[model samples]
Target: MKKSRLILSLLLAFASTLASAQSENPPPVKEDFKPSVLNQPGKEYPQVNSQGYVRFRIEAPDAQKVHVSLGLGGRGGTALTKGADGIWEGTTEGPLDEGFHYYHLNVDGGTFNDPGTLNFYGSVRWESGIEIPAADQDIYALKDVPHGKVEQILFPSKSTQTSRRAFVYTPPGYGKDRSKKYPVLYLQHGWGEDETAWSNQGHANLIMDNLIAAGKTQPFLIVMTYGMTNEVKFGQLSSFDITPFQTVLLDELIPYVDANYLTQADPAHRAMAGLSMGGMETRTITLANPGVFSYVGLLSGGSISMEDLEKSPDFKKNVKLLFVSYGSRELDNPRRGPWGDPKENTAAVTAAGLKTHFYVSPNTAHEFQSWRRSLYVMAPMLFK
Candidate 1:
């Protein structure tokens, strides 16, 4: 009897300990996910939960392996498991950053777009996109307010020997008042993306519309054009020459815009801003042509050091607004560029009596989210 009692006590203690351990673990995630806002009109496979966890469902019946190219760190991506119902499904191991993310699928070692989501141009190709629902998404949302028109134009580029395409955004009341001329902001996209990125991916027009509607910012004209003039590969950054692109932008695009549109055609009324490689181009072109653009912005691109200003004698006098920004994640490593910290560079410029501004997008990386917010913050401060 004593032996049996001891055995029973031991079993009960083990069971209690197991129960406690189970109780300490987190509960299974709730099933309240919805289709991503970037999904196709009728498709509903890629979904995101309130916690920012992305769930994907693909209908590849015979594929041996299926993977999503978006997840946590590195590029391991998310592997989908085939279920008994012949559908491959999986959820991200952790939450993703809140904003637009470009991703695709690798099915049996073949690259393909997720049929459910709308395609965005990135990484030199059209890839699937998903939005994680940013908390401040309303800033770029389409409302009933007065809207702006994004006009597409083909400008003659003698340097590139082609009629280059550019998109110009005219503010809400632009057409109403034909006598009034607005300041122009020449914006550029990242490496692989072209001019369409600012309107399509970054929602530049909508951001300007919302800001103008709320009387938060003055109405201005925004011009976006292809930043690449030479055919350079992805890995060949050293060979990427800015001379050709600078000529096209400064000589061709600017002259065409000034003649065609009602713009305040002067250095003080002109600004240049770009993202990533576009930012690099902005830094180069703005510094080189200091008298052409008075306002300069570099979003997640790089910084402007005191040495850069010293090289350009007119930069301190001609430039008015020097706006620089980056994603918080990109700043984790202090070593950003050859000039070292971007914050310090901006400070040095500000100390030199130039109007400088710096911004960091929280919980984001070197993606469109950072650039979008940068535009929003920089718009109000331009031509002021």
Candidate 2:
């Protein structure tokens, strides 16, 4: 496949899997709705119950109609009916997967954010966000444990000809113990997202905090920056060039990170991971740079194939670990397209005698939930 078309197919598959439906006869939704955790203070309109169903109540008496553009299976979304009291009310047809989702309100044909919720940067804009409580919510839960800090750092990039922004997650006690050096992971966000997506939407710092509290993973630093994927429209995704962002990450960011922070500045101690389009970038850069990054992860992104091994023999010798993951909904949803099996590709790579691990996040799609779980699962295996 042409390089551009290959990425296009992956993007297409990600979109196709968003269409889902509940069982033909779902159980009755209990009236146990409460305010969403992401809701503004004292706002009770947008709520989720024990079954994962969402309820929205918006007050817009003068508006002709109000509609929420978030629905089960990414279908028609929820249509609101104006009550006599002038408040619009609606409910999702089915329960949503546990995690964060970006949605907006269409009030009288105007795009607007929900007044009752906090906005998250997504789809290249600040969209209202909602969170569904997960069964494994404690994995990324904010606890009383000592936490890592995610600090925004500006690094000069000669290739981009600008001061680029990147978020660095320094583990707890990084400041107190000045002599200790940690490994670094260069993480990238997918299309339509910038440096803040991982910390804001993915709760990466909190995830690491909870993990470290329980002694689950080694203390390390996670660096997040833009992938420069949103410049080309989805229609022109194939024409997306990796060179500009690659230079920013390789030539500029790495050196700044090494000099500014106490890090084991060697290939074996460095890692790279990304999601969706970011994964495509990770694959291209990790293989091409050889000893630059020893660990690699592709979360809901593409996978390594036998052809990849043939083209980059150094990948087998230099890289230490390769982690691949996808949401179960993206993998098994019958409505998806023929994007080929990521599992098969992962298996072929594993059989090639290179260390590889594959994972599937149950009951989720191409969203942050899958990537969160992928990070939780992959972090322990890095720098081992």
Candidate 3:
């Protein structure tokens, strides 16, 4: 009887331990092993093929209706066929443009994502689907044209701490001849844009290449650099540091170009110009560092006043030709007109005994079209 009692007590203790361990740590669940999509798949997303039309599959267990929204003017609701596997799928017509498009999957009572496609974008903060080599492919990238060499060069700036790299565009005839000297153009991009903005979005390289090939403009080096400091973004000029960038341009970029290529170091052969914030930077640099640049161009410049010109001692003496161009559309309401106008300020500078030329293009407002036209008009005046 004593042995039986001891055995029974041991069995009871073992059962209790097993029960406690089971309660603390259960077996591995297959639901936990499933991916995020399988766990809560609801919205169906559209997929883009090489031809461009979007198609996709959606799996909504409790959905009554399903539809997909397309681009700019795309709208429709097509019933999806419920498969034996409980997945609904449908295809849209073909050949969509190769750009970004937003879409959402609408189900019966709610909407969800497409579990079939990995590509997705946010709604309020929705993701987008990107198509390449479809309807709206890049024209230049597809063209069989010879592209000039572009390089990102980092140097010290008098304006910033770690300095930045500027994009330098050397024409086709850059290094073939040893004794050829090229004029230099210091082109600037607008706010939130870096040196690559002109070459990338502005198509400046194409413009220059065509001009040089046709003998319209002389072969020259284009130096595109960042014009604003970090402090400019925050609306605080007191914290801005530009001495380093200025030092880099004068000390590093210029010397390097003058040594590597046949360049005229004199101010008469160099031109400085920019758009928006870059315009302000050009104005400031040209006025402060007199005799460093002969020609200065401003496109849709913002918040410039007579005070800025009157305060600068070098404004009248050093500047040879000041080209002030603004879009006629922007001189009116909103966007950029209310603070201070470029046309009014240019007139003020002209009245202050500075040589200035003003032109306004029609139907534009601080856009790439305005800047492109500005460059087309300004390049001829450079190194003249």
Candidate 4:
């Protein structure tokens, strides 16, 4: 009996130890971490269409307050309610019109991104963003229309051995009609942005896509490249050093694109366009290599001088169109660089006998909206 009791006690002790070990080492968690969500299954924001308030709902259990800031020229309003389930709701008076507006959310002044929507940052930071398909009439403001293709391709830069990536957009029917070559527009992005700036922030692709579909604009290939030569950033350095960038485009980017795509490589079929520093680069390229690009569109940029025109002996005979554009609101802001002052350069280019189109957008500022409008107006002028 004693032996049997001792055996039973030993078994009980072993069982207790095993139970404790198993309790300490539990199974791994199954659900991985994910971004916070406002609307779960069966929960959603009110169905507001393209002309109503901009609505946002977020679930932040501990957040005491939530608010959104309206971008461009006005202050933002506060949210309407906080639900029992830790969800907060807000609305604004405008679904801003057909132009691009950037915004952000301030959770008691601590910033947070919208969980439900695709975010877009401008030529600068991504933290600043706005909601699209948010009560707006503009189709390009995030409608689900058939879109054009913007490809990111790397090409050799004579300025440096490290390959540079450029953004290219082929119009809707670029592949379908193989026999007919399309006119090419070599576009450049401003400093601090890659080739994606024109398409994403500037909405160049959508503008071209819409224009081509409507037959309002000629179908052309847009080749947007990095504007900096060997410099890491474009505007961080002065425009005087951009000659090497011009060389890279001329010696490498232009030739590679022409060879790979179905493009009419002739000067008459070639053009250049850019914003800010990009605009400056465009002017430099056309002036240095006269007869290379027939048409030039300068949007919110281009720091050309009378001397530049005089230096280019063939500036008059080779060039076809010189379109210089700037926002009326940007004239006061020196941050727009040298292109804001178009009078002297305009007179110089006109005196050189090139057809000059000086365009000014009243009340528009040195922002992407101004550039987008500039592109829309200037695209129709190409290959005509």
Candidate 4 structure lDDT: 0.63
TM-scores of the models, in the given order?
0.91, 0.95, 0.59, 0.68
Q: Give lDDT tens digits, candidate 3, residues 1-384.
A: 343233223322221210011122323322211122212244334444444444556776556667655422223434566777777766543333332333456677456654444333222223223332322122223244444566677766444556567788887857778777778888887654566668755667776766665566776788887655443543333344445456666777787767766787788888888876567567667767877888888776543356866677666677788898876555543434322556767777788787877877554444555566677667766777
TM-score: model 4 vs. ground truth = 0.68
RMSD values, in order shown: 14.0, 2.0, 21.6, 20.7
Global lDDT of each candidate: 0.83, 0.85, 0.58, 0.63
Clashing pairs in 1: none
Better of 2 and 4 by lDDT: 2
Residue-level lDDT of model 4, residues 138-179, one tens digit each, is 524444556678888988665577788888898776777778
Name the candidate that leads on lDDT. Answer: 2
Ranking by TM-score: 2, 1, 4, 3
Instruction: Give the C-alpha miss distance for residue 322 in model 1, angstroms.
Output: 0.3
Model 3: residues with Cα > 4 Å off, grouped in runs: 1-147, 156-163, 228-238, 302-309, 334-340, 351-353
Candidate No. with top TM-score? 2
Best first by lDDT, ranked: 2, 1, 4, 3
